[model samples]
Target: MNGTLYVGVTSDLVRRVAEHREGVVEGFTKDHELKRLVYFEAHDEIGAAIQREKSLKRWSRAWKVELIQKFNPFWDDLFDQICG
Candidate 1:
C-alpha cells in the first residue's frame, strides 16, 4: 500500500480518470499506476475541491491513508465504481 498517490481536483472526474488509466496524460500517476481512485469527494464548488486537494496533498501518508481507510478500509480500487 506504499504506492504513489497523485492528488488533484477535477470537475469531470470520469473523463480525467479515463485519461489517467489510458496514460493519455503523462505524469506521476501514469508512471506509477496511481490511477486507482481510492478516495474522492464531491464539492458544490471547484474552489472548495481545490482547497481540499491542497490540504490533502500536504497531509502525511499515514493521515491520508487513514482518511481513505475510513471509507475504504481495504483500499479497494474504486475506479470502476466511480467512473462507471
Candidate 2:
C-alpha cells in the first residue's frame, strides 16, 4: 500500500512519531493515514531541520519515495526502531 509523506521539525523524534502513530495530532498526516514513519533525518538544530524539511518538500514525490526506499524499502513503521 502507498502512503503519504510527512515532513516536520521535532525536538524529539520518538515523541513526535509516537504522536503521529497514535493519532494525537490533528492534521494532514492523521487525516490521510500517513503514519508509517517511512523516512527521517535527524538534525542538531531546528533551523537545519526546517531547512531540510522544506528542501525535501520541494522534491518530487517520486524522488521522496526513492529517498525513503533507500533506507526503508517496505515503508515500515520506524518508531519502534527509533525508540529502540
Candidate 3:
C-alpha cells in the first residue's frame, strides 16, 4: 500500500481490517486507500485501546513511521496473520 496513514481503534481487528479492505465504510481509510495493516498492538481494555489510538493520532508522521518500521521493518500487511 501507499505511505498514507490513518489511525483508529476497533474492538475487532480482523473484522475492522476486512471492512477497510473491502471499502465497507466510507471514511479516511477508504478515502485514502489505506488498506495495509502495517502496525498494531493489543490492549487489555477498550478504554486503553482508545487512549492509545488517540495518542498515536497525535504523534508526528515521522514518529508514527518510526514506530511502524520498528515493529514491521518491511511494512508487510498483517491481515492474514491475525485471521489465522
For all predicted structures, in order, the TM-scores are 0.90, 0.89, 0.94
lDDT of 1 at 7: 84
Model 3 TM-score relative to the real fold: 0.94
Compare candidates 1 and 2 on lDDT and give the better one: 1
Candidate 2 per-residue lDDT, tens place, 1-84, comes to: 365667788899888888877889898878987667777798988999999989988998888888888989887878778988
Residue 5, candidate 3: how far off, in angstroms? Answer: 0.6
Over the stretch 1-84, how does candidate 1's per-residue lDDT look in tens digits?
687767889989888888887888877777887667888889999889999999999999989888889989898878889855
- Badly placed stretches (over 4 Å) of model 3 are none
lDDT tens digits by residue: candidate 3, 1-84:
237988889889999999999999988899988788989999999999999999999999999989998999998999999999
Regarding TM-score, does 1 or 3 come out ahead? 3
**Model 2: lDDT of residue 53:** 86
In order, candidate lDDTs are 0.85, 0.82, 0.91
Instruction: Mark the regions of model 2 whose C-alpha exceeds 4 Å error after superposition.
Output: none
lDDT for model 1? 0.85
Q: Rank the candidates by lDDT, best first.
A: 3, 1, 2
Instruction: For each candidate in turn, give its C-alpha RMSD to the true structure in angstroms.
Output: 1.2, 1.3, 1.3
Question: Clashing residue pairs in candidate 3, if any?
Answer: none
- Which candidate's lDDT is highest? 3
